[model samples]
Target: MTTFSNYIPQSNPPLPPWETLPTMYDLPSDNPEEPGLPDDFHFLQPLLLYLTFQPINWNPELVYSAADLNLYYDIQHPLWYKRPDWFGVVGVGKLYKGQDLRLSYVTWQEPANPFVVIELLSPGTEDEDLGTRTESAADKPPRKWEVYERILRIPYYIVFSRYTNELLAFQLVGGHYEPMNLTHGCLLMPEINLSLGLWQGSFRDIERLWLRWFTLEGELIPAPTEEAAAATQRAIIAEQEAIEAKQEAIEAKQEAIEAKQEAIEAKRKTEQLAERLRQLGVNPDDLDEFL
Candidate 1:
């Protein structure tokens, strides 16, 4: 049987689009000087990550997470740093020096390193994010991948692409990062007692697929806005129930008033009949025995 492949004139079959086009694997050169500026998606995605990052097992005061923060790692070269899209450091005070807010994260002065770092995929930064570059500039700081893996040894490194809605996660193992297999479209982090997954729901008045956190048991960690909406719905339901109860009480009261009126009318008719029997010279009291 002649197939579609046989219809081609060339001896070799044409390669698929995936082979010819540029992909995350073949991203551009890693030039730190030309770091891509963030767009609206970059701003929004990090905010979602920041809001839903509720580490249930950790104390609220100790769980600190932020987006677009410079993380200074090396003490020798204090100026050298990498600003991750979002990062979370557990077991550290939310305030710097336990007094005021921090401007940047300094590794040497901090109590602990970032437990996880997330990089939102931008076209210009994909190469460095995926560690495709073998080395960095001669006189400059190390690449982001090297800084996270070799220097800081962050426990988890995640890269998410909003354009493709793809999520990639790696865990530190034996001085190297090992890719983690997602279970049921979610990656579970037992340390945080939460799992990261794709949730197809509305956030910030926008409906789209979002990467949000869930409990290890698959319960959604609601944002503040969602909580407010749920509270409003509960209030509405409670008000309706109250109205129905009030109507029922009113109906019962009206029914009692009608029953009392009916009893008074019956008594008045009996008295009128007794008065008529006396006028006709018939004893009303002895009429029952005669009948």
Candidate 2:
């Protein structure tokens, strides 16, 4: 029974809250609105990727990787981004512009897109990470698959589930992603002279199946701690070998001294025997003729 004209009129159509709300910059990086915050596995798995993402064919200074960092892809929508679990770039500097740490990875500003992106599948993000999620509406931003595959065109996309210890990998080919085959239990990337595979062992003192890097020949790439431990072991072995060598030298010197002492004693006995033969009035030089 109230007159409709009395109420304040709204716009022709109200925009969605996302369209009018604060941009990514206005909100804190860890804002509640952000999805996929790192759980225990998410944190550790990405760390493993970051530690062992060495590309033997590339310069160490030019190889860079990051975890859970905002990767701004679209220049049109500068605020739109995806925070990958872990990503690596081959031609980028370790620091932003070789001067400072990067707050986020902006593709438009950077020289290269990610060569590889790894997503740890979780209950919350399994569908999206595997590219099976429902497509987004036309007005909404594209899904992670679309962003990585179609927009950014990342070379490699990897998904791993810790619960089942399963690994899935895709390589971009002819502008679309194709499932990659595992060679020798690893996905080989010859350009980097490296491989990606799951390793069953202890990491960070926790033993489990973990996704890690390897050589194309299926050799495990040692983490920094593992490398340090190996170096220590080599040093210990070298020290032991040196100690053994020193003991051998000492034994040889002692044997030579004993031989010299024995020779001296024999000479002294011979001299005394000669003196006795002379005192007995028997010429010692005549003994050879009697023989």
TM-score, per-candidate, Cα-based: 0.75, 0.81
Candidate 1 lDDT over residue span 1-291, tens digit each = 879877857588899999899995566446667565566667887788888888999998998988888899999899999999999989999999889899999999999999999998887788989888849787889998999999999989999888899989999999988999998788989988988888888777778888888899888888888888899999999999999999999999999999999999999999999999999998899899988
Tell me the spans in candidate 1 whose CA falls farther than 4 Å from its real position.
Answer: 1-34, 137-139, 252-291
Per-residue lDDT over 161-256 for candidate 2, one digit per residue giving the tens place of the 0 to 100 score: 888888999999999889999998999999899999989999999999999999999998999999999999999999999999999999999999
The candidate maximizing TM-score is 2
lDDT of 2 at 95: 97
**Leading candidate by lDDT:** 2
